[model samples]
Target chain A: MSRESIVNAALFALLIAVPLGALATDEPFIITLATRAVILALAAVGLNIALGIGGLVSLGHAAYFGIGGYAMGILAFHAQSYTPLFEGPFVIEGTKLMPIIWLVAICGGALAAFVIGLLSLRTTGVYFIMITLAFGQMFYFFTISWPAYGGEDGLSIYVRNSFPGLNTLVPIQFYAVCFVLLCAVLWFNARLARAPFGLALNAARQVPHRVEAIGLDPVRLKLVALVISGAVTGLAGALFADLNRFVSPTMFSWQMSGELMVFIILGGTGRLFGPVAGAMLFVLLEYLLGGISDYWLAFLGALLLLVVLYGRGGLVGIFAGKARNHD
Target chain B: MTEPVLSTHALTKRFGALVANEAVSLDLRPGEVHALIGPNGAGKSTLVGQICGAIKPDEGRVQFLGRDVTEQSTRTRARSGLGRTFQISALAMEDSVLQNVVLGAMGAAGTVWHFLRPAMKDLTIRQKAEQALERVGLSDLASLRTGEISHGQRRRLEVAVALTLSPKAFVMDEPMAGLGAEGTRELTALLDELRQEAPILLVEHDMDVVFSLADRITVLNYGRVIATGSTAEIRSDPEVRRAYLGEES
Candidate 1:
């Protein structure tokens, strides 16, 4: 195995061992923290599909994340309140099943991403970033204005959603759910990085005109990547909402989008488990530093500056040495 | 008297007030390198762009393989077997030399949408990429990072990428730019053999390579084709001399 692959394996092992160790110590809180890292990492993995592989640099991924959160919130709210989502059209019922909510979140996120991509993909570089940020802010305000599901204050779930055999209320069980999903996504990401689509997307990102000259549509590739990225992030948003048992407009905030980007940069862009490593560090820093002072974000800012200046590939790059490049 | 593989009829492009190309007609017959030569700012790039579907002509038709493709996208034209190389080295510098060719093969096969299967493991793409690399004599350097390759190798790599498309015609823009004498000689020899695979519409500034390799030559000036004839005829043409060759020789 290569050095990077070895590093990746060690990272996965450490992630798996964390919650297991927390469980042994009877610290359910640590398990919850691990779950938070896993979910955040999952969301970052979604963003990395566009940002790292596709070189989209989207600044508005929170739109998809918010959509996922709202999908879960609105459904669970209706299910608990014993109300129909739609009475006149066809009596659409709400579902508290985790699978159903996740599917809805994915579809919703994909649809939103498709529309946003259509408009934003027309522009590139910083303009693409601005347009996506605009779309994200648009979603944010739309949620705030439309108060049917509590709007800015957000929606609250009476209980956590259900799986077939697991009590998701247990911290370790929920962590397992998030952890398994993260692993599945990481696998999918690795496969995508080696796939023809991944090759085309990476080429498109580097030299769009070169890709076009070679008979591949760069914009179309980026659009597909954005849609897939959004869908995955949406799934994470649903899980996040479930963990908190609440959904709010804060999920769609620009800061949330920035945080997702931070995770990728911190771990390593394009690396399969970059988000996992980044999220682990982020959560750990938040917990450890938040205990000391309220100026934790300042410390993060300094660290990010250091990484951007000296750490070319972030934490994973430092561990794995030089980038693998073509892999 | 054989039909041209690619032809442009009175192609014109206007950038506001400046006429980049005006009523420029050209053709690339099978098994010939039809050189498009001009001094700097003679609209050679613009005319080439119109032929390659990168720039739309204000009023004209571009026929390829007996079909009118004036309205086609650059990618559509390329996938239909119109290969192209840029003046500057437009490569994925971060990728390995072999990966660049594989990307081209994948594009040629229209398999870029295949998301589950690994590209390297695909025998067809890998084989095609290897073949193209071998053709360019870049097989030994296939694993090297493209950015680290010699300037001449990058230009050959560009041709290798275009070759993966199995092109019926090539629209090469200044492929000889920035190459030394020895490098240019090697590339000229390679391009000579390439004409058997596909006719080339070559836009170049190197008169020696053009005089040596081109079967026919088209000279342009002020966005217009001043002369189109055999290389000897073009070399002696008075208007061609006055407009372009006057500065060179």
Candidate 2:
């Protein structure tokens, strides 16, 4: 195996070992922190598909993330209250089933992404970034003002959602679910990176006209990438809401969108486990440095500058190697 | 007469007040190199853009294999076998040479949407890309990143990409540009062979290569066809001599 493969393997091992060790030591909070890292990494992985492979720098991903969080909150809220989601329209009932919530979250995120992508993709570079940020802010204000599902104060579920054959209330059990989902998404991302769709998307990112001259529509490719990315990030949002037993308009804030991008940049933009490494590092720094000062983000900004200037690739690039042959 | 593989009729394009191309018509017949030569600011690229569906004409129609494709997207025309190479090499610099060719093969096969199977391992796409690379004498450089390759190799790689389309006609924009004498000689020979696979509409500044390879010559001056003839006829035409060849020769 190549050095990158070895590093990826080791990273996965460390991710698993940390949580399991936390479980043994009865550090439920540490396990919760690990779960947060996994979910954030999962969200970053979604952004990586568009930002890394497709070369789209979207700044509105929190809209999808918030949609997912609200998807979980609304459904479980209705299920707990014994009220139909709507009086008419075939009497849609809210259910706390994890799989169903996940399905709803994915579809919600994907549908929103399709509509947003259609409009945002018309502009590119800095304009595209501004448009996405605008969309994110739009969602943030809408959620705060709506007031139907707790609005700005946010909604909270008294108990975590249910998963069959496991008590999700247990920190280790919940972490396992998020871990497995992260692994599956990572595997899917890896497969996509090698697939024909990925090859065209990568080429489109580098030279769109070259892709067009060879008979592929670059915009369509990017739209699909954005949709997939949104769906994955949405799933992570659902898990994040469940982990905290809370959902908020803050989930849709622009800062959350920027944080997801940070995870990818810190790890390595296009590397398979770059999001994972970046997320873990971000969490580790938060845990370690959040105690030291209220301005930990200033340090992060400095580090991000260093990565942008000299590091070129990020943590994975430093530890493993530059990706050879688009690996 | 054999039907022309590609043609444009009364193609005109305007940028506000200035007209880039006006009433320009051209055709490439089967198994022939139809060379388009003109001096700078002559609107050859503009006319080419119209034919390749990159530029929309204010007035005109582009027909490929007899179908009017004036409104088709650039990719649709490309997929319909209107292969083109850029004047400047437009290639995926980050992709390996094989991956770049494979991308073209994937485009030609219309299998770019296939999401599960690894693209490089797909035998059909791999073989087509390999065959195109072999045709351009670039099989040995297939594994190298495209950016790291020499200028001449990138030019040939461009031809390889177009070839994977299984083109009915080629719209080449200065395929000989930036090549050394030996590189130019090699590409000239390869392009001569490529005509047997598909007719070529060549745009070039190299008069010797143009004269040697062109079965027919169309000269453009200010977006208008100044002359259309064989090597002997164009060589003797006073208008062509005064407009273009006089300054260079």
Candidate 3:
């Protein structure tokens, strides 16, 4: 087998082995941590589309994540209250099924990203980064002040949403669902990174002038990638909300967006499994450090600074040597 | 004849107090090689930029193939058969040489909407890109990454990219700028062959190549055309010598 295939197989084995070992132990803490890793990885994968391939440093991905969570929380609340979303021509109610909630979350996040991307893409460089961050803050503030869906106090999901042919409340089964979705998204992300749009997106990142010279509009291409990225992350957010059985204003915070970026950097930026590795390391560090001291975040910040300054390519790059320009 | 293929009328561009191009008017006939020569900062590159839609002329018209395309964007102009090679040799360095040519051809092919469809898999685009590489003697190095090629080879790749568009008119800015002696001969030969296929507006600094290759030459100094004539006439013109030729001494 080729080196890449061998590496992939080994990775796949580790993914199955580690999770299976966690399941065999029946330890709720380990299972829950594993589930969180998968969900957070999914979110990071979304940002990778824009950040890795498109070269768009969106400091506002948390906005989409929060939007996804809110979609789930708001729908569940309205459904529990037995109130229709709108009393006009059609009555839109919510469901407790995982797929339905995920769909709403993805669509909500994608729509918001499309609108934000349209405005943000008008500017480039630092302006684009700042505009996306501003838009994200706008959404966060709106959610905090809206007061309709528990506002600052947040909402509690009374029960874990059901999936077809499974008792989702069971920690193992729920972890399995999250694992499958994460794998599916990773597969999809891999395919997209090799696709034509992905090529154009990478080309735009390297030299936008060349992309434009080839008659492809860079703005439109980036916006499409951003929307797709936001949708994927948003779907993960819905699953996260269901997993935690709670959603709050903290979901929309810029700190969450920074954490998402940090996750990608920790694993390896632009590498296929970078987000996965990053998410695992991030959560493990948080868990370990949180146990040691309340000021763990300061340590994490110092570590990230050192990585950014010295280790440009994160852990995967260090282990794998240099990644070929795959895009 | 045939609407002159490409024409510019009193094209002027200014950056604050500096005039980059001052009412530069020129016409390129189909199947002709027109050379634009000037010393550094004589506005030859700026004129090429305006013609290629990279920069807008302040108060003039640019007509390409009978249409006034002065207001069009760079991509629009390229799609309409006006191709350009930058002086800096701007090829997609991450992509293979073949892929860069493929991208150029795909630009003219149609709107590339389907991302999943591999662009290189198209038989026609592949054939055209291969043909372009062959014309520039780069067929052997087609699969090499653009960044891996030698500087002269990259220059040829840039020309190959422009050729893949099957352009009616090519605006090449300093095609021989950084080429060594042997590389310059190869490029001169390539330009000679290209002149048979389409009109070329060659912005060049190499006098030997320009004098030998150009059917006509226009010399600009200080953003204005100082001389326009046959090679023999340009060589003998006292005013042209005083402005540019004497400076070389």
Q: What is the alpha-carbon interface RMSD for each candidate?
A: 1.1, 1.3, 2.5
Query: Per-residue lDDT of B81-106 in model 3, one digit per residue for the tens?
Result: 88788889888787788878877777
Off by over 4 Å in 1: none
* Clash-forming residue pairs, model 3: none
RMSD of each: 1.2, 1.1, 2.0
List lDDT for all candidates, in order.
0.93, 0.94, 0.85
User: Which 10 successive residues of model 3 chain B have the least lDDT summed?
Assistant: B110-119
lDDT of 1 by residue, B100-214 (tens): 9999999999888888888888998999999999999999999999989999999999999999999999999999999999999999999999999999999999989999999
Q: Select the stronger candidate by lDDT from 1 and 3.
A: 1
Better of 2 and 3 by TM-score: 2
| Residue range A131-157, candidate 3, lDDT tens digits | 988988888888889888888889998
The local distance difference test score of model 2 is 0.94
Give the candidates in order of DockQ, highest first. Answer: 1, 2, 3
